[model samples]
Target: MSRSLSIIWLFGLISGFNIMITGNTLNYWLAKENIALQTIGLLSLITLPYSINFLFAPIFDSLRIKYLDKIFGHRLSWICLTSIALVFFVYILSFLNPFDNLLLFASISLIISFFSSMQDTILSAFRTEIVNKESLGFASGIYIFGYRFGMLIANSGAIYLSIYLTFNEIYKIFAILIFVYLILLIVGVKYFNSFNVIEEKTYSSHTSSSHLHLSLYHSNTSLCHSRTSLCHSRGGGNPVNNINFIKRYYNHLGKSLSSYILKIFLDSRLRGNDIGKSENDLSLLSFIVLILIFLILYRLPDNFINVMINPFLLHLNYDAFEIASVGKFWGVMGAIVGGLIGGFIMKKKNILDSILLFGIIHALAHILFIILKIYGKNSTLLFITIGAESITGGMTMTAYIAFISSLCQGKFRATQYSFFSSMMGISRSIFPIISGYIVVNFGWQNFFLFTTIITIPSLLVLLKIKNKLQQ
Candidate 1:
């Protein structure tokens, strides 16, 4: 692989591994410790930062970290700092006993998640900014390959290692590995810089009107219409003047409220921030909201299944090594294969089509879990089910990365990508809170069925925006 490709792959691997340790890997450990299912479900809350990191994504895009920026550049500086901090916390997390000091354990886990989210936010922006348009697909495929590989090690490898090592020991070993990557990041700063093609641009106050402006305008117009009708109902004199006054008053109020909300979650300079720009700008804001909603819904099945899978496997009487070997190792192999398939399909098809195809397959893959439930600890069936699920999961995830990367604008690349990604994280971080309860109450088969059915909404949303995405 080329140097740039290698860096992209390594960052993806590190990020994928880091995210999993706090998620599925940790869930497995908790299950093994005999923790209550509800409590384990609540653990997803610790990752809240992942879902909301967009609130601060603009800072990474527009602000500079003093000395670190001088040495590592704006994006890399944040990446390095967050990596170091995440590794440090992971190492410390290893020393805590969840049974005795649950609060401390949870607190440290939250901190680890915060830094991990920060690292991921900046790294995604860096990845998006570094590669040119022509190479993005190949680069995205490589990164997904690396990411799945890292998740494989974290999920299956960590479990397999637990045969001879304590969870504490495993965490420390992983921390050391992450720290090694950090050292390489510092050493290779110049190499990465060589591939940095994006120029630093000054922020401008002028807003570009597009679809977002249309959405804002429509939003205000709707409000004014509602108020204008209320004025007519009052049967006041000078009806035309009253209607005009209501429109003016409500439009200003709506714009002020919309602007405040945008300033909080988006860069003030977004194309639709200023009201009355153009119909296109309103449409742009509405499109952004639509995309964000689509992103949140797209991965629902996968996220719902993830939190319970390891625990479910253990309940099937599969040993840690067996589960790790099949679920983690071969599963990752399947994902890598799926990534290749996704890339090939992308070359032949539009991105939305690829996403829809993979999404259908992704939802269908959950049915294998139902079959596994019926088979009852049959190792061969377990292998087949996990391999199939991982393949579909990989394809859908790769398409998702490509879809979002295509949407990022240059100057706001980091903030916009982060917003999209953070919305995606909502599925990963929040929806799983109910996963454990569902399994506990409805049983695994029903839980799997529910997950499969829930995927319909995302597909429906995808279809609703099909023309917009195609355009």
Candidate 2:
């Protein structure tokens, strides 16, 4: 790997870790502060700005800062700026007590979400630019592992720290960590000397060619010199060449888009023929439904239990430290193991089979949570449940990620992946909010049952897509 690519990976780790901590730990803290359950639901709304990032993605794609691109390259400059912003925002959150000023905390959280979204967009684009297609999966895995580790520290370590210190103190420690990360980022920026600068002469030469082509195609005498001059001014001299290049580029782009659209329509027809050819073979659709049902059922138990974990802990007389410890250590560890295993499975088996296996494991994992809920006061049960749940959840997530990765076509990877990820986020955002309400109204046991029921549809969908999923 190039030095610049290595530096970017390092930054990815730091940023991922920080984000995981903030995302996972904040819920526990808020619950401790006596925030209303409804308000907790509203926390999901903070991600609203993230959807907006997709709209402005094109702007980032087109524009680059002239001097900054020279200094740190386009993507790195964005990363550096966003990282600094993130550090400052995280630090500021340490000072405000959410219990005292809920609005202020909410506002801060929104700002953090916005910048984080921007950071995510730029970082993803940068990763694609720096890393080759083959290495991308491994890179994503490493980044996720680092992120999960950060969550463990924030969730478990922060909670443990809170046992001895005040929340303010815990926040201060986290702030210091962010500052250290920022310093390291600055150092990386200085060390990685791989900035790509576009030459002015190249830009001019391309422009001149474009203008000359346009002048020849059109017979209007008045349009010739004026159009050429305008192109020269914008293109910085070689207007004719620039115009031709742009015309050819657009023509190619149009053809590519047309082909892509045709492919989308044709894929179904091809799949249909394949199905007919293999009539004796079990249809992919059936397998997909089976897997989808399994996925829905697997998550159902947690969906129910997750809603009540805070309340149950409080009822059982567990302290913040214990909650944090379980989440950080067990949760983080499970996630890493799960992700790694999922990646390995993808490498070994088809995506559909891997997902099916994940579904089976996921459903079994929920049984542990059921045991914990039934034996609420047993520390042993809690420990077992925590470990089991974390591992299962991690594995399930990893399988899903791998499945999504396999689905992407190389040309439209970013746009398609972004859309798929957003759907995942939508499910996450909506489910938690609904789960919270269900827990409040139906109680934890009933909520678990409800979760089980909801999962059936997801499983059915998965089963329907089984064959395509394998591809």
Candidate 3:
């Protein structure tokens, strides 16, 4: 694997840890603030970036700071920059008292989520360059394992550390950790890019005239006066031209997009290469439509529960430490097990088939929570509910990610995947907001039953495309 792929895996850990710090570790803190349940449920709206990063994904995919990229390479430079932004925004969170300034806290949360989602977009694109589509299941598994471990640590780790440190102090500690990570990551990326620069320079020197001519044709430009732009970039005379060059590149590619996108999305079919089609889906348009339906409904149950789980547990008289340890920490452990199982299952089975199988388990896993709500707080029951939900959730996520990876456009991997993921996040974010209302009016048991009921539409969509979801 390339250094870039390795970096993405480790970044996954950071992403998991940081993202969960809000969703799980600080779950009780946010709930305990006495804010209205409706406002707390709408917290998923802060994560809107996860669903909509495609709007700006092209910027990350193409544009870069010329000066900074020279030192850190294109992707790494953005990663580092975004990571810094993430640290700043997250640190700002420590200073905001959610109890007194809830709206400000929510605003800060939105900004942090934007940066975190951007980091994820860059990392996914970086990984696409190195990891094979067929291997993405295993790669996602490995990534999820590390990600969930960080979640485990953050969930349990932060709570345990609270015995000695205040919540503000804990936030500061996390900020410091991010800063340290940024420094080390910069050093590593510098070496990696430097090595590539050397390798490319040596190789370019020995290229035959024919190969060099082919490179010019492939670069889609004629004004290459020197060999540097052939491999490095298209800043022939001035760095400013690079922006125009990228614009032309994408505009031209957009014109040349597959009939699938043009016909399905733009209302006209022009002959062109199939840009985002995978091995199984001959009609990428239909495949993606079906996938979108599935994506929108895949995790409705979980998102509904997630909005109220902490408050529900608190209602049952569980302390923050208990929620962190049993709910967050042990749940992560279950996810790790599920990640392993999910990886193996997707490796052996078709991605969509795996999704169907695990989606069922994922939907059914809610029964455990319903059980917990019914039986009240038995430690055994608590562990069982958390464990079952975590395992199925992890498995479904692995399969869903693998399926989405298959849909990412070859050239526009970041933008395309962002759109798909954002489609899914639309459901995730909206349903959670409604969860507050549901639990408040209809009660937890009825809300959970509704979650289970909503899972049917996604399964119906999955069935519509079952034949095409094959290996």
Candidate 4:
């Protein structure tokens, strides 16, 4: 168990490191070189792959590398390939002058983002495959710890190291670290692949690729039968019968294919709903819709408040150092502790109960911000408020990851989880824009109050679907 958790943690760490290097560290380097602000803004195009990788995520699910897939399992094979590719590109980028080789630098950076995003998708599926459902919450906690630690190194650690090291040297060091971690990852993958003991229950009938293929075959077969019966009734000689059969065949094919592709982006349970009649009509669709709504809303309170936090603190006349101390140092500590506690709860209570408990606590944690507002910038109160917020944020996020992991137990786990994650990301990105507007119009006190109120809908959504999800 320790070994497995270590591997999971390392996966998260490496993912975080690579993403930050390509994003924050690289952007910082560009700025230090006196790149134009407009050009620097355009550099966001390089990281665009992360947002759209779900479009190509199915490739990792269905395609297998020649030699690597035979050695590592399908998911791990893709992970290994992408990891090595990421290291290669990062190392290459270390040698290029961004100003001299602007096109090359941008191309390589985009490739790195592409591979990094692919690695993330494959790693999520791989993690889901290796860890049993019972330990998902704990595993996710450890992963988050490693992820945040890695991000710290890339952001704060790299910035501090810049006093002694050039950007090229930093990139080289990160490339080397990634390579070394790859070796550890290979050993861990081997270890987990050998066991083959952890088995997860499927969430719906359309969970696996085989199930999907079977459904398609059955649909086509049933259509053919129905067409043949019509032909027989029409004396089996009319040209219209054959034309009608052809039209219907293509029509059904289009719908099935369209639904299959649509399911990749929209709700994953759509395929399950379309494939066959459920024991309770509309139950599965309602269940998934409820969960999706919950997922989108569950973390809004946390995210909505977080976007305005630094600005809010600065507005309160707190200096940068004080905010960094509480927000970065102590805040991270609080989150780590909360994650572990969340894991314990998930391990003991059923997931629904655990989610409900976390949801309530998460909502209440927002009230601390209102208190912080009332107390002014006192260090003790700030620490208490930030500490509570971080802890609950961490706990809520861990539960969210665990909850999604539970749903993504299918053959297309990578694609399913990617789509779900993309939805969450969309919510996180859009809500913050509204946060700024609210702070501008309503004042900080009302904004914090609004954040607290926002949690109620998600909690209600969770309760509405609890009985269905458990099945």
Q: Give the winner by lDDT.
A: 1
lDDT of candidates 1 onward, in order: 0.70, 0.56, 0.66, 0.65
How well is each residue in 402-447 modelled by candidate 1, as lDDT tens digits? Answer: 7765554334444455456677878788878888888889888999
Residue pair clashes in candidate 3: 51-422
TM-score for each model:
0.73, 0.72, 0.76, 0.59
Global local distance difference test of model 4: 0.65
Q: Write the per-residue lDDT of candidate 2 for residues 1-471, one digit (tens) a residue.
A: 656555556656665655543454676677777777666755756665564565545344334556665666556666667667776777788888888998888788788777777776666555544554556556655555555555556667777887788666777777677667666665765555433423233232322211111011111121111111001112332345435444553454456533533332222222224332343223534442343344444454454455456665765667776677664576667666776676566566655566667766676666665566677777677777777777767777766655544443333344344444555555544456665676678776676556555655656566666545345
Look at candidate 2 and tell me the lDDT of residue 387: 77
Per-candidate RMSD, Å: 11.9, 11.8, 8.7, 11.9
Worst 10 residues of 1 by lDDT: 224-233
**Number of clashes recorded per candidate:** 19, 31, 1, 0
lDDT of residue 274 for candidate 1: 28
Q: Write candidate 4's Cα lDDT for 1-471 as tens digits.
A: 888888889888887787777776676667566554445545655666776765554456545567875576556677778878878999999998787878898899889988987887667666666666567667867887788887777755775567778888988988898888888888876765443332223212222421111000112111111000000111122345435544553453356533543454343342233322443434544555666788889877776665566467766777545654675567778888888888766666655567788988877888888888887878988888888888887788767776665555334455455556766865554545566667767878999899888889988888877655344
1 versus 3: better lDDT goes to: 1
The worst-scoring run of ten residues by lDDT in candidate 3 lies at 209-218
**Candidate 4, which ten residues in sequence have the lowest lDDT sum?**
226-235
Say which candidate scores most in TM-score.
3
Estimate the TM-score for candidate 2: 0.72
